[model samples]
Target: MVFGFLKKRRREEIRAQPFPAEWLAIIERNVPMYARLSEADRDELLRRVLVFVDEKNFEGAGGLEMTDEVRVTIAAQACILLLRLDDDDYYPALKSIVVYPAAYTVPRKESEGGIVREDDAVHLGESWGHGAVVLSWTSARRGAADPRDGKNVILHEFAHQLDQEDGAADGTPELDRLAFYAPWARVLSEHYLALRTAARTGRKTLLDQYGATNEAEFFAVASECFFERPVQLRTRHPELYDELARYYGQDPAEGSASA
Candidate 1:
């Protein structure tokens, strides 16, 4: 309890410090979504970013050098997910971010007919239940630069972070109340099944086909589409979009219209 209070006090101090000019310039230049946010939301996001950057340990791997630009750019995108959430701990389960210069490869194991095969798989980002997120800086930057692409590695991985907060990545994060779960499960499951059918039939989809992998992936992928392609998601999948908007406490489609 004492340690928690100290951490909270430290976070308050960090939040009180003025946001640096260079960080604002980086957000303006790298994250297009920043321009679309209302001034109040922008200020709130900046406060979250400050605490996020201060609390999380950032390390560069695969020959990349860590810098303020990399840290602030990633923090801004990650904190956008928390802008309206009632949580004060930020990502309580997250401890560090590991960034690579570009896409990196990890070992993959596949089992077919009772035989297990190991191979290398390339990835842009991954979120672990053990309090770490790995990202490729190149992909992260691209996602931030093209806010309408419906694919942001930082957002996707951080969504997984949210999903893991309750000690499980079952496509459901910690909702504000127990009452919110039924609707959330119903809507997301409907869309998940639809996406799976669409993927099997080679039909085009607004939400990423990768979401069909499972419920956890569906939530993360849906989160990416929620913020990046809000207008399209709202138009095509109103039910799915509504669930996300209710959970996130923001209407990006409305923001898009005003923008």
Candidate 2:
């Protein structure tokens, strides 16, 4: 009861404030993906972003700093994912978004006490436990500007969050009902294994090799493709595309066509 009241009160506080008009303009102009949503959906999404930006705590790391531009920029992109699915309400689970100036490295240990850093490896975004999203400003802008290339930092990170919500990044999120799980497992398993095998054999495929890392990554990478390259993903891996369609309850290719 106490937590619910606190959340309600906080939302009320945010509802009273206004978001920057310039940021909303940016979202509409830069993200054609957002333009596909209905006007009502767009209004609701902007409202959600308004509250979402207010709800989460943002940390600017690696010399980055938080500003309304940063918050609105990130929030608009993140909220775009919710425009088409059940993602919005659950996103409060992620309370912090750590933004770096560019693609920051998560250093790994090398053999024989050697340190190696690959500065050119740029990851646009990542999401972490307790509702944290990390992103690079440059990639974020480019991603929103062009959604057709099957690469989106915000969608990519939020896909990670969806996988993590069930307490494991196991290439699955909690389904609406138990019945949905059987087909989900069946289709995802088949496609996941195929992609994994293809990755090893160096076969050409639509999904990125990063998906080969695990089921979690498979879900995230596939999700990036699912939204950005909907027609391509649907054609390349129809079963996986169908399962994601069932799960997300939206079809981007279909949606885009109607638009």
Candidate 3:
């Protein structure tokens, strides 16, 4: 109990700290969505970013150097997920962020017809259930730079973080109400199946086809489109869009309309 109290106190202090002007500049310059957020949401996001950066350790990998630019830029994007949550714990399971200068390779094993093939597979970012997120700096910057492209590595991996918080990465995060489970499952399942059918049929999709891999990836990909291409997501997949907007508590399509 004492430790918990102390940790809460420390976070309160961190939240009270004056947000650095340079950090705000970094968000303004790197995150296009920052400008689209309402003033109050912007303030909340900045506070979340402050606490997120303070709590999560960041390390450079592959001979890359970590800087305020990298940390703040990454933190801003990650914390965007926490905005408006009723009980935001700032990704309690996430302990560290490891960033490579560019895409990195990891060993992979693929089984085809009972034969397993081993090789190195390139990845832009990966979210682990064990409590770490690894990212490629180049992909992260590019995702942030062109928010409308409907791809954001930080958003994608961090959405995985949210999905894992419930001890599973099954497309459903910890919803604010138990009642949300039914619709969330129905809508996301329908969309996930649609995406799979679309992929098989080579139909164009608003969401990245990568989501068709699994429910977890579907959630992550949907989150990217939720924030980056809200208007289209709403128009093309309104049920899917409504589920995400309800879970996120942000109607990004409304923001786009007002913008």
Candidate 4:
């Protein structure tokens, strides 16, 4: 017990260190919205991000070197998700982040009836429950330029980490003591169905139809939209807005909107 206590203490001490000013400035320069965070909040995010970068294993793809710029670019976006929430909890499950130079082929091998073949799948980003986040530098940078479009690779995958917390990305997590799961169910269900309908009808949707794939994707995609474009989401789907507001303990429209 004493050993465990000391280990936890050390973790907290690591989490309290100051992030380099130059690193903070780099993120702020690339991601304008990152500048909006309050000084204290900035410090806290830096603290977590600093440790997050160090703790994770990052490898370069296509000959790109792993540099502070690359890690900070990705960490800053991941930090966005943690800005309003505690750094502990579900996301702690992720221990490593692998960054590629650009979208690359993730090959999967399979056999059919007595034959075997390998298929190369092209991907920009992928998150695994085994505690790794794989991202493309190009896609990551694009997501940084504008967090309002809901296509943030970091936010999308991190939201999946949140969804996977309760052992499955089933579009739900452990809520606060006062959280109302019923409303969450109702709102998410409605929007999810709407997204499905749009996909079925081949119509463009406010929330990406990728959300229609499953309950978990719906939750993650909705989270991207929730933080990225809350006003639009709330105006179009007020019920979902209310539900997410209660769920995340945030009114993103408060911090991100221009009145």
Candidate 5:
């Protein structure tokens, strides 16, 4: 009971702050899906965003200056994933968000059966197991601007954070019920294999071919497609889409005509 009261008090305190008009304008102009939410969901999202901005540290990288626009933009997208979630402990492990001015190059290591190769590669975003998410500001803004492209770096990275909540990024997040895990594993495994085949055969698929790289990447890329291309995902991969819809508790396609 004490914990519940504290949580409620914290939420009330966060919600008591005035949501900036400019931030609301940013959401209105940038996040297309924000306009599709019902009034109640929108209010909830705003509350979550407020709490998220209060909790997470935002740091600028590569000569970028963190601003309210950047913070709120990223927070709103991250909170979108939490909108229908049951708990308010949004990303308990995520503590910091690092934003770069543009696509940043990072050192990469590849191992194929004990042969190791090192190189530098440009990436839009990355999520770390130790509770930090790195994103390219340009990609993040563009992703918010165009919501139906099925290529949201913010969603993709935050999905990785969710995948890591269980201390591993194995494509399966913590589920509400034990039984839900069985179907989640079954459906995602089937689709992951199909994506691998599609990637090898050079066949077009609803999900990004990057998903075929690994199970963890599959979940992240699938999450991007789930939110950004829901109707198409539902049409092409109904069972996989159903699993995601069940977990998220929101049918974005049903809410948006364009989706």
Candidate 6:
């Protein structure tokens, strides 16, 4: 009760502060999906954005200085994932966001059966299960600037954060009820295998081919397509689209068509 009260008070304080005109302009100029939201949803998104920006620590990495534009842009897209949900926990497990100037490389080591391979792989963004999200500021800005491209580093990484909330990032987030799990598993598994088949067969698919890599990657990639190209997602993969709509509590198909 005390924590809820404190959170309510903090939300009130955040709402009481005036949203900067410059930030509004930046959102309008950069995020096309902002214009597609209904008036009430827009208000809710703004509220969530304010809370997200206030609660999370933004750290600079790779000589990238954190700015209001960087923070707000990243927060806005992340908050969109939570727009229809309740309880402003804001990915309680996530504590900080680290921003890089551009694509960054991290060393990787993996063992298969008995062999271990080591190499460095370039990444645009990554979400750690522990407490951090790392992103490339350049990729983030481009994703925000072109919301219709169906590729967003922020959305992809944050979707991983959501998936990790249940102590696993195995393509499933916390659903509304235990009963929903069966259907989620069925739909996701079927589509995931289909995507893998499409990838191997050189067939065109609506969801990103990268999704075929793994269940977790599939969820994140599907989320990007769900928000950015809902119409195409619905037209091509209606079952997957419906499942996402149920999970998100938002029908983005109309918004995408109108936009």
lDDT of 1: 0.95
In order, how many clashes per candidate? 0, 1, 0, 0, 0, 0
The segments of candidate 5 whose C-alpha lies over 4 angstroms from its true place after superposition are: 1-8, 110-117
Candidate 6 lDDT by residue in tens digits, 1-259: 9988998898889977878888888788877789999889888888888888989999999898789989989988998999886646899999999999999999999999999999999999999999999999999989888878899989999999999999998999999989989999999999999999999999988888999999999999999999998988899889899989999999989976766
Predicted model with the maximum lDDT: 1
Which 10-residue window of candidate 1 scores lowest in summed lDDT?
Answer: 86-95
Give lDDT tens digits, candidate 3, residues 1-259: 9988998899889988999999999999999899889999999899889999988999999999999999999999998877877655789899999999999999999999999999999999999999899999999999999989999999999999999998998999999889999999999999999999999999999999999999999999999999999999999999999999999889988888888
Task: List TM-score per model, in order.
Answer: 0.98, 0.86, 0.97, 0.88, 0.94, 0.95
Full ranking by TM-score: 1, 3, 6, 5, 4, 2
The better candidate by lDDT, 1 or 4, is 1
Candidates ranked by lDDT: 1, 3, 5, 6, 4, 2
TM-score, candidate 5, is 0.94
Model 5 accuracy (lDDT, Cα): 0.91
What TM-score would candidate 2 get against the native?
A: 0.86
Output the better candidate (3/4) by lDDT. Answer: 3
> TM-score of predicted model 1?
0.98
Q: What is the lDDT of residue 119 in candidate 1?
A: 99
Please give the lDDT score at residue 90 for candidate 1. Answer: 85
Better lDDT candidate (1, 6): 1
Runs of candidate 6 with Cα error greater than 4 angstroms are 111-117
Query: Compared with the true structure, what per-residue lDDT tens digits does model 1 show for residues 152-175?
Result: 999999999999999999999999
Model 5 lDDT at residue 87: 57
